[model samples]
Target: MKSFFSNQFINKTSLILLSLFSFSLTSCLDKEGEAPEPTPVAYVTLYHGAPDAPEFDILVDNQRLNSQPFKYNNYSDYLRFSTGSRKFKFTPVNAANSYVDTTLTFKENKLYSVFAVNRLQDMEVLVVSDTVMTPAAGKAGMRIIHLSPDAPAVDVATTGTTGTSITTNLNFKEHTLFKDVATGNQTIQIKRTGTNEVLLTLSDVALTAGKSYSLLLRGFQTPPTGNTNILSGQVVTNY
Candidate 1:
C-alpha cells in the first residue's frame, strides 16, 4: 500500500508538470503572435531638375536602379523603398565624379519627390512630400513647382473662359499648394508676377479627373550654355 501511494504521488506530480509545461508553451506562442509587424515601405519618385547636369544613374543604398542614365527634366515613376535614412547617389555617365550624393530619412505611408537641382558643379536634391488622394468627381488637383534658379516669381492662369489666376508669386525653388480644378485637356500659361509677360504657354495638356499633378518650372532664364532661352516646364502625375 505504501508503494501504491508513492506511485500515485509521483504520477500526480508528473501530470502537474506536464500541464504547466503545456501552458507555458502556449503562453509563449500567444505572445509571439501578438507582436507587431515591421513598418511598411514608402514611395519616392525622382526628377532631374539640373538643366546643365549630365545624364546620370541612381544608386539607392548602393543598389543601382538602372543602366540607362537619367537626363535633364527627366522623371521616374514612384518606386517602393523602406522607411529610414537612405543614401541616394547620382553618378554621371562617363565621368569621374558623382553628380549628387545625399542622404535623407523618409516616413512610412508617404509619397515623395526628389529633385536633382542647380548647376552641375553645385548640384543638390530637393525633397517634396506629395499628396496622392483622389480628387472629387469632375475635378483634378494641380500644383506648381518653381525650380528655375534665375527666374523671378510667377503666376499661373488657365486659358480660355476659365482664364483666372490659380497661383501667384511662386519664387525660385518654391511650390504652390494643390488645388482643385475642372478636368480635361486644358490650356495654361505661366507669367511673371505682377506683369503681363507670358513665359510659357502649355496647350491641350490632359488633366484627368480624380488625379493630382505637379507642374515643374525648371532650367534657367539665362542658361550658362546651350540655348539662351532655357526656361522650361514639365508635368508630373502626383497621384
Candidate 2:
C-alpha cells in the first residue's frame, strides 16, 4: 500500500511540471510574435507662388514653423508631422494677424504639397496629394504646374527633335497629372495654345529612374514697366 501511494505522488508531480513547462513555452512564443507599435507620420512640402506678396511665416496648431519666413518663389524640403487633423495659419512677416487660416487632415505615410498662390488679398492655398510610388524600371514620373497668373494657356512637349506631348492646354493655376517617361537627359518645349511659337525651352533636363519630379512655370508673361518679376521656370524633386 505504501508503494502505491509513492507511485501516485510521483505521477502527479511529473504531470504538473510538464503542464507548467508547456504553458511557459506558449507564453514566450506569444511574446515573440508581438511587435512594438509603429510610429505614425506624414510628409509635406511648402511652396510660395504668390507674386507681389511679401515673405510669410507658417504656424501649425498655433505653433510657429522653425524655418524662416518664405519669400516669393521659395520652396521647402519635405517636413514631417504626426498624422491627424491640424490647423494651418499663414501670416505675413512682422504681422500680428494671419493672412490665411485653414484646417488640414493628413493620412499616415502619405505625401502632400501646399502652394500659396495668387496675388495678395486674393491669396489661396493649393494642396496636392503627391505620389511616391517608384516608377517602372528605367522610367520616371513628371508633372507640370502652371502658376504664372498672367501667362496664356500652353502645351508642353518634347523638344522639336524628339519625343511627344506630355501635357496640353495647361492654363494658369492648373497642374497636370503625372506622366511616366523614359529616364535620361530630356528637353521640353512650351508653346502657346493652338500656336507653334515656343514660349520656353528647357534643355538637358536630367531624369532618373524610380524618381518623381514637378516643373513649375511662374511669373508674368508681360510685366508692367520697371517690374522686376520675370517669367521663369523651376524644377523640384518630389521624391
Q: Model 1: how far is 17 from its true place, Å?
A: 47
Worst lDDT run of 10 residues, candidate 2, spans 1-10
Tens digit of per-residue lDDT, candidate 2, span 110-138: 98888888767778888888876676788
Best by TM-score: 1
Clashes (N, CA, C under 3 Å) per candidate: 0, 0
Worst 10-residue lDDT window, candidate 1 = 1-10
Clash list (residue pairs), candidate 1: none
Q: What is the C-alpha lDDT of each candidate?
A: 0.75, 0.75
Candidate 1 structure quality by residue, lDDT tens digits, 81-121: 66778878889775545778889878888888888888878
